[model samples]
Target: MSSRRLVVMRHAKAEQDGPTDFERPLASRGRRDAEAAGAWLASQGVAPDHALVSAALRTQQTWESVASGAGWTLSPDFDRGLYAAGPESALDIVRLVPDSASVLVVIGHNPTMAVLAQLLDDGSADAEVGASMAGDFPTSAVAVFSYDGAWADLGEGTARLEAFHVGRA
Candidate 1:
């Protein structure tokens, strides 16, 4: 089976407003961090085939900044299900990715994203990064995992954390 690459990230900081959480805007720091994350990916020569983004305003804006900074031209799929969705929902979204895509990116919230990275980590790679991930998956942090199996077959402890990155713009 071909190896698969998954990049999971939580949306950056957002303004604390009460109008509605879904409409919360990304804070200035969040915008900077998101752009820095994109630049970091570009520096690392990372190009994901597809991006499954959360439909919330903050998440969408996060992907927008990241894509612009990274020079990614691919259209992203924004899904409402990802807004406040748990790890299981996130996994379900990933499972829907076409097999033709070798690399996939997921941008959403946490502790779902954070916990999912921990739960899915096989610990066979990037042990140190995985360990740090346990403490905090701060805003704009990105975790890369390599899984061997169909997306449908991904389960707990089935993927190995390959790399983790956090940057400033």
Candidate 2:
């Protein structure tokens, strides 16, 4: 069976002076970091067939930078629901993904992003990577998982945490 790849990433750093939290844009460092993240994913051979990104400005910008750095030409769906979605809600959105997409990427905000990575880990892979991820999920942190089942079948502890990376530029 051809396994599926799920790339879960937190939005890059953002300026704190936006008109509202949802409207905050990525800072200069965040853009560079996200681009670096994209390059890292590319190096790891992560070619996403689809991208689900939050409608928040920071996330959108992060997706753009990542795409540019990775040299990908795919467009992402801007989702307002993902903006404030917790890990469960985010997983719900992921479950709605089309099966044709063998590789999927989700860009969202914190707590949820970090927590979702932990929740999906099956603990059958690299323990050190899991430990590092458990410590902190800073800006541009990413967790890649390998799942043998369909997207609909994905759930807590169903996927193996393949890799963890933090992009810095």
Best by TM-score: 2
Q: Candidate 1 versus the native: TM-score?
A: 0.94
Q: In model 1, how large is the Cα lDDT of residue 4?
A: 85
In model 1, the runs with Cα more than 4 Å from the true position are: none
Predicted model with the maximum lDDT: 2
Q: Candidate 2 — worst ten consecutive residues by lDDT sum?
A: 125-134
Worst 10 residues of 1 by lDDT: 125-134
> Could you tell me every candidate's TM-score relative to the true structure?
0.94, 0.98
Q: How do the residues 48-82 of candidate 1 rate in per-residue lDDT, one tens digit apiece?
A: 89899999999999998898878898789999999
Q: lDDT for model 1, on a 0 to 1 scale?
A: 0.86
Candidate 2 residue runs with Cα over 4 Å from true position: none
lDDT per residue, candidate 2, 1-169, as tens digits? 6999999999999998799999999999999999999999999999999999999999999999999889888999999999999999999999999999999999999999998998899988787887888789999999999998889888999988889999999
- C-alpha RMSD values across all candidates: 1.3, 0.8
